[model samples]
Target: METAQENRLNPFLYLTYLLEKLPQLPDPQDEKALNALLPWSPSLPLICRVFTPTK
Candidate 1:
């Protein structure tokens, strides 16, 4: 079942979704720190389709 929290955030699920993608990031460990600072663009969905949105 989907969590109630996911329902609260629209467009994107939450930062957890963003955090999960950190490991796959191409940047070095040091540079990965800036990942969160990256802008959210249409390319976001390309990272992980799993957490995009059920509906």
Candidate 2:
């Protein structure tokens, strides 16, 4: 049987750890320019589908 402490360390905790380690956001003007310069990517659609609200 799994211990209580081990059970508490779940996937959500790992996700939070990953988010915390990400680089800080850039300036809004630069961010907008970067997005405009970048090509359309399928990553956003995949992530949205993963976290989409279920009916």
Candidate 3:
């Protein structure tokens, strides 16, 4: 059985862990990868915005 403390995970720490484990975003020019991510044709700017990391 899990305790209440074990069930509670820090949001910030969880986000950090997820970000660390996330693979690098594929290049916008890579058609195969972009196709996998988007169903329809996506513009360069859209891809850039989606993949670009926020400060």
Report each candidate's C-alpha RMSD, comma-separated, in the order given. 7.8, 12.4, 15.4
Candidate 1's C-alpha runs over 4 A off are: 1-12, 28-39, 46-55
User: In model 3, where is the ten-residue run with the lowest total lDDT?
Assistant: 39-48
Query: How does candidate 1 score on lDDT?
Result: 0.46
Q: Write the per-residue lDDT of candidate 3 for residues 1-55, one digit (tens) a residue.
A: 1221243433344345435433555565666654443322232223222233579
Residue 35 C-alpha lDDT in model 3: 49
Best by lDDT: 1
lDDT of 1 by residue, 18-52 (tens): 66777666774655455443443334443333445
Clashing pairs in 1: none
Model 3 score (lDDT): 0.38
Superposed model 3: Cα runs more than 4 Å off: 1-6, 24-55
Candidate 3's TM-score: 0.30
lDDT of 2 at 50: 27
lDDT of 2 by residue, 12-32 (tens): 443453354334435545665
Shift of residue 8 alpha carbon in model 1, Å: 12
When 1 and 2 are scored with TM-score, the better candidate is 1
Which has the higher lDDT value, candidate number 1 or candidate number 3?
Answer: 1
